[model samples]
Target: MSVQPDLFDRSLFRIRRHRALKAAKPGADFLLRAVAVDLEERLLLINRTFGTAVDLGGHTGLVTQAIVNAGKAGRVLRADLQVADPNLPLPDLVCDDALLPLGDQSVDLIVSALTLQFVNDLPGTLIQIRRALAPDGFFLATLPGAGTLTELRDSLTRAELEIRGGAAARVLPFADTRDLGSLLQRAGFALPVTDLDTITVRYDTMFALLNDLRAMGATSILKDRSRTPISRRVLFRAAELYAENHSDPDGRIRATFALVTLSGWAPHESQQKPLRPGSAKASLAEALGAKEQKL
Candidate 1:
């Protein structure tokens, strides 16, 4: 199937707006900094063969700087859909889609943090990353996994259905671990691995969480829906439902963020390959029949 390039462009705009508004919020920045630190630690384990590194969806060059600080200054590149801040010290900052910017086998490492969930063609993007990497290159990414924001989503759904007779907009599209691993493999990355980490954040009220999402530029992007402003009645009702069901005994509402980290390597000819169909000595059905007869 063909990929939609426009969706990525739109997502970039949303992300840009989100970062701009929430730039001063220390809590969100703290979470992202932790992730960036973890990514740097993982990069250190790689053999130094990867002289050149490219960061996909590198919004503010945090991860890119991490790579540079690891002693790869001249070879690090940061790519994003929007024009990156020119002042952020980086070797290269290109305004382009992750799916089709870098050259074939030109980069040794491609890292994306909390960026893949908004991408509609994740497998296609992975394929592009694979193509951009030299043999033995690595692709590392972090995305929101399923179960993120369950409390907010469920409360919104229940309240919207009760008040407006329909569902509200979905906040995000997160992938499961199995599907993520398969996608990496299908994209020609070898030794695919995925692991999940759950983070639960407490908010004094549901409205506080909602405002944080807005400041973070996490509004729904459903184009077909009406752009009319949400009514105060609906908002209050939603908050009530959220507090009743999503709040803890201490009165703080909880929001869950499930981070799924993925890693894969570019394939090499030296790797083992499965035997071709009809090349095996015996079929599974034949082996089963023989075993039954012996029994």
Candidate 2:
């Protein structure tokens, strides 16, 4: 069956609003800083070969600044779903979604950090990335992986069940390492690789962690959510449960950030080719027999 194009869900606006509110917080700033550094490194590597690069989801122009400072790329395009501020220093800022606004084979490299997880049609976005890249170009991205924010999720689940007889909306959704690799391959990227890194952070309270998420523009995008405001009683109970169960002896709540980095190249005709079936000199069973004999 042919896949359908995934539309941007309106429910994500709520999550974005919460994250925008939290962006000024220290923890959120720290996380974005680290992500920006990673993006800068990727851009530098790509710049070694290509003169033009694009930074998708370049919020506030941090990565754009890094690219400009590297002085390798002749032109850097900073694009995002929305332009939160028009006064950012980025020279080529464009406000558009990832799947649109880019032309085929127009860019040398496409770098996106901490952006793909919010996309409902991740495969489509990747395909678009491939289309936007020049021949033999590179695409690099970083996204939250499974196991991120588990502490917050667990605490919220427990509190909601105790108070309202069910769980609250899921705050985040992330792809696993293997699945991300498959996605890159499915999107027609060559030499796809995915690596996972875990970052553990301690917060003074669960509320602090939530605030950071809000600042980072990371939140739930549930479509059928209740419009009623969250009650203070529920919030306090959730905090108490989180502190009691998920806190360390130092009285800090813990949260894990699972970062996944993916890199791939646009396919080229000069690259090595895969062997056809029955092309190998030895069969798998023969190879196993040889190994057994060696033992």
Instruction: Compose the digit string of candidate 1's lDDT tens values, residues 199-288.
Output: 888999888887777655565655444467777787788789888998899989899988889999899887567878789887676867
lDDT of 2 at 279: 95
lDDT score of residue 245 within candidate 1: 92
Please count the clashing residue pairs in each candidate, in the order shown: 0, 4
Worst lDDT 10-window in candidate 2? 82-91
**Which regions of candidate 1 are displaced past 4 Å?**
1-24, 47-49, 69-74, 86-91, 270-295
Model 2, 121-151: lDDT tens per residue? Answer: 7888899889888888888888899999888
Q: Would you list the C-alpha lDDT of every candidate in the order shown? A: 0.74, 0.75
